[model samples]
Target chain A: MKYVNLVVIFSLLTFFACTSSDSDYQVSDIPGGYMPGDTARDFQLKNVNGKMVSLANYENAKGYIVIFTCNTCPYAAMYEERIIELHKKFADKGYPVIAINPNDESEEPGDSYDEMIVQAKEKGYRFPYVQDKTQEITKAYGATNTPHVYVLNKDRKVVYIGSIDNNARDAESADKFYVEDAIKALENNKTPEISKTKAIGCTIKWAS
Target chain B: MIKPMKNVNLVVVFSILTFAACTSSDGDYQGSGTAGKHVVGDTARDFQSEKVIKFPELQEYITTSTDDKVKVINFWATWCAPCIKELPFIDSLRYTYDPDKVEVLLVSLDFPDQLSKVNKLLQRKKLSSTVWLLDESDPNLYIDKVDPSWTGALPATLLVRNSTDQRIFLGKELTKAELETHINKLLN
Candidate 1:
């Protein structure tokens, strides 16, 4: 009788442990909100010179292309030439490409302001290479990955968010240029057929 | 009576075998500290935290979950920028929610060498949330175990409320509004 009672108690404990809680956790899915018509949030990030720059600072701009990049991501490095091209193609036409390093220097020493300067100088980045000192601007823009791109209209709202293109692992078969298409559509005053995409790159490093 | 005794002996042998098998493999984490130390490469300064759990039975340290509370599990690395940016907001969320109804667990991915840095950051920020350093070494083996599709991203968050359902967010940062909205949705 004692043995039977012990078995019963053991089974009851197992059942309770298994059924009482279903709080098994997994990694979360990407947050969503942006679409073809969403307006971009205004931001003030410190430039390489330590001056705060905001959307209002570019008063006469037609559009803005904000790219969340870093000094370390190989994928972002792959797109450096493309980024320069975009700035050259659009800055005089009223759309200026802005690059922001959102990696925390405390966690990623290579992404420090001084390193950013060296990288910009080496790559000859003509556009503003801003530093998100506290990463407030990066979070405000909903940028989750390095090389995450956001394109805004003249009124400063996010019209496009995601990768520079569909290709990152290989350049030989690189076909889609999503950011370019989005900018062209914005220039033509039409909705982009594809407004968002999944950015593939290194995860943003946060400070401990 | 002899035959019955023989049968009883067989049952006893089977039970012992079963117990041995279960206890030997289940929760028997024998892989202790083979994850390689971070060597500075061309990319950046890499710091890895120690992986050996000094206390083998530390799993018992987790408190029992309450019925009314929702637990937020955040997997982060000290070097991840978005994780750092979103942490203050997460702290703010803890303050905003009722303590009895919400719990936040911050799991650090720092190398064992950086425990001091992690502790210092927590102290500097005055974070009161429960903090734990994940002592597993092999991320490639363990990352998928955490979630098959995680892709080893930092600033990953898991929201749980007693096994019925859970939500995962893989990204760099989250705003207070975003965090609150998701928490509310999950509670409902």
Candidate 2:
């Protein structure tokens, strides 16, 4: 009887452990290890104008500043102008910023394609405000959050994966401009001092 | 004949276990709290039926509970289906646990306009758990403040036994078994 009780307890423990392990939030590590030399993957995403734009469209560009942002996240909103400015600063030098809205429209109605266009126009976005229709591109890029950024080299490989800068709440408190520093380093043919940092923003509303 | 019967029984047990595991993982118990549709950017005053607490003071409320008890702060929203489903289970938990040892705090992420509706829902459910509306407008700002690693997902939970060791669960809906296990582990 004691042995049976012990067996039952052990089985229950195993069951709980298995369940907890299965339910444990298995957040995928942002696929990293892509250095300055790796080639970037080419993807075609729909622009706010309902036009598909590919990496090849930005021909002869030195690099690409791919940012996964959305209409709602305050963090993304705060960095909107900064993103535009980054593109304006680098577009002439052959690197143009490409913005993608990865939030599912079904979950967040404001993130619908029409709303994206409206928001883009309202914000005066000069860059291509693309929509990840199936969120295939977003998932492929492993963009889990709005305002999650990836600086890909001209070769199309991810050179940096993190925030636009250090400050999301207060711009004044930002000490290290990681994105800017990475872009400058890439331009200089030198490796960025810091390659990654945790991104802060709204969770991407995937069609689960 | 007996061998065949035993094999059939084995199959039946296996199927039952599989169903239980699947349901345990994904099942949510639906409650009777239906929220009325309210457009975004609506004023806090528009929805007078729901209770709205001052947003900034939520943290203080959670942290500064005068009672010496374990606080289970559940972040939920009326729009979220899983959150609605978990309320009854949470109420059950509140009933089962000792009030002096455990306190359940249901922090609604519902818009200020929907507060009255939520309050009515709570009242209808006869839920006596200490409830508060999270008044923070922007999740991006407050989500991190709540926990730097939080992804601002609804139906998330934070179980605080004090400042030192707190368990944070980020997901939609939790089963009674899972809740019991967590509570037992923490309490023990």
| Top candidate, metric TM-score | 2
Q: Which ranges in model 2 have alpha carbons more than 4 Å from their true place?
A: A1-40, B1-96, B100-188
lDDT per residue as tens, model 1, A1-93 = 011232443355456557742211212233443445677677787777667778789988989999989888655776777788889998898
Assess every candidate by TM-score.
Answer: 0.49, 0.57
Q: Give me candidate 1's TM-score against the actual structure.
A: 0.49
Name the lDDT value of residue B78 in candidate 1.
64
> What are the DockQ scores of the candidates, in order?
0.05, 0.05
lDDT of 1 by residue, B1-188 (tens): 00111223434433443553456422112222322222333111111212224222223222244465677767775665567777877866667888777778777766444554564465445455666676543343344444333544566665666534444443445667777776776676
Per-residue C-alpha lDDT of model 2 across residues B1-188, encoded as one tens digit per residue? 00111223434433543554356422111233333222354221112222356656776765674755667778875555557778888866766888878877788875444443565566455565767776554343466556543545556676666543444444334677776666665565
Model 2 chain A: weakest 10-residue lDDT segment is A21-30
Query: Model 2: how large is the Cα RMSD against the reference?
Result: 17.1
- Which residue pairs of candidate 2 clash? A39-A157, A40-A156, A40-A157, B49-B116, B50-B115, B50-B116, B50-B117, B51-B115, B51-B116
In angstroms, the error of model 2 at A61 is 1.7
